[model samples]
Target: MLRVHFTAEDLARVRVAPGPDPMWEILLSLHVLRQRSAAPVFGPWRTAVRATLPDDTRWLLQLAPPVGYSPDFLTPTAGSCPVDAGIEQVLSTPVASLRADLAQLDCPRPDPRTDLLAGGDTAALTALGDALHAYHRHALVPIWDEVRAVVDADRAVRARSFLDHGCEGVLAALHPTISWTRPVLSIESRFPQRDVHLHGQGLVLVPSYFCRERPIMLRDPSRAPVLVYPIARDVRLTCAGRRSLEALLGRTRAAALEVIAGGCTTTELARRLGISAASASAHASVLRDAGLAVARRHRNSVLHTASALGVALLA
Candidate 1:
């Protein structure tokens, strides 16, 4: 363990939520870069992208470069195999041939947009986007499977390296408290002592790339588990149950309930719905008080499950 000082309050604040600070976003971007560089294939890449940090920090900053500047900007020299060659090869192979070999196969027809986007024609960007969206929905599963195989093999090596180099502590620090609905990677740490206004432990990971210098770590004098990590980026989005539910129970509260679908921790619910953890907790509290949701403690986290009332309302 690299002896980094953190208090109990620091640890307590690390619940996952939506709408992460700026630093968390940066770390996610770096992770994305690492993912893209490692696999350049589909399955492992998607799996790596879907991998979540298993810590209790709620906020995550998602780093995204300008829309089109991702793997394209990081292309290697000519003659090098394209990162997605394996996916392309599989996708290009005759569907009947693939179905004959792979059991439980249900291949869809190829969309033109993927080919157009691959070609990078300015005139075809719109059509390509539409096609890519369709392709992503249909073809992503198989492609991700292929990418995952490569990514997993690489991760095994990296995991070994991480374990050997006393990097597990660092890895632990990077573990997220909550999982995001979208694919993301993020950093985590405590806040500065001066800004410790929140009652409970509070952790923050902003976008890493945006921070020119490392952030100051905030520790509670009371020796609480509060910490901070200067991250790269996090993802944020508003979530709601279906619109009908919203109409029945006012949008604000309905949106809160929608995000709690799988019995999420209060912080997780907040993060998924892109609201403050406090707000999420308050909303959940109201729902619980009304017998719309029930809170249960699992390990150290408090998770909320939809009650009969909630189920009926949502239904």
Candidate 2:
């Protein structure tokens, strides 16, 4: 069990990332590629993108072992950071810190890139950056649409939970592998069990589409404490599923729900669904009453969103 110790101040400061981290997606996708069997949530992605992996992914494979440390700089303190910022941080790492972090990995002596990083070798760093960019392009970008949908769906669900049940409820129900007990949160980890004390820096709970079964955290945990965990649901939306949705919820209502899932005003929904404003209002009312959609009025316009229940059923 990996236990996270938090203070009252930390509780007050807790935050969850609004979306998936591009850096983490790149790193964790490498882990998925290396495996033949991943969790059900990643199966479709793995199958879709496996053949597209570049041969030169060793740049990532070097650090991301199946079971070992990857450089901590690769996993930033901010739960949501741009890819360039993360890459720069890794490249600018002090020589001592770079080597020290890599030393924890279960790899052989002297990671060749460590020397290049330590020496501030610009040419080697560019090659490294290029390698990452190349890997992401071939492996992740193709399936990024799927990735975004999963992360967005997860965020929507969690936001609903927060609204319905408050902070404690959200934490308590984050994942089946996680247990919340007052100021401490525990997660089952494949790594050697450890305890992390958050010295009042609070914690960022980041939902990840590619983070596998276990919840991951910074080894040092002294700065920007974060816990990256898998999101809810295993089944993803498929073309076949979309085609069958009309069967499940009728053609017009299904179309309305589909548009509503991405968020739309009733007028927008009606126009998109090719129906009158009154027809759109009726469909919206039915969905809302069924607990499958929500509509909130802003001035004269009404915005409709698929409820968590709605998204789950559609998925």
Clashes of each: 81, 0
In model 2, what is the error at residue 27, expressed in angstroms? 1.1
TM-score of each: 0.23, 0.75
Best by lDDT: 2
Candidate 1 lDDT, tens digit per residue, 1-315? Answer: 112433445444443222222222222333443344424322343354346422211111111232211221111111113224423432443434323322221224323433343455444444423333333333233333322222222223233334544333333534344222211222232322232333444443322222212332222233322233333222111124455334437677888777664567778898888889898888887766555565644335565666545666689
What TM-score would candidate 1 get against the native?
0.23
The local distance difference test score of each candidate is: 0.38, 0.73
**Candidate 2: where is the Cα deviation over 4 Å?**
39-44, 47-50, 109-111, 241-255, 258-315
After best superposition, candidate 1 residue 304: deviation in angstroms? 0.5
List candidate 1 segments past 4 Å from native: 1-248
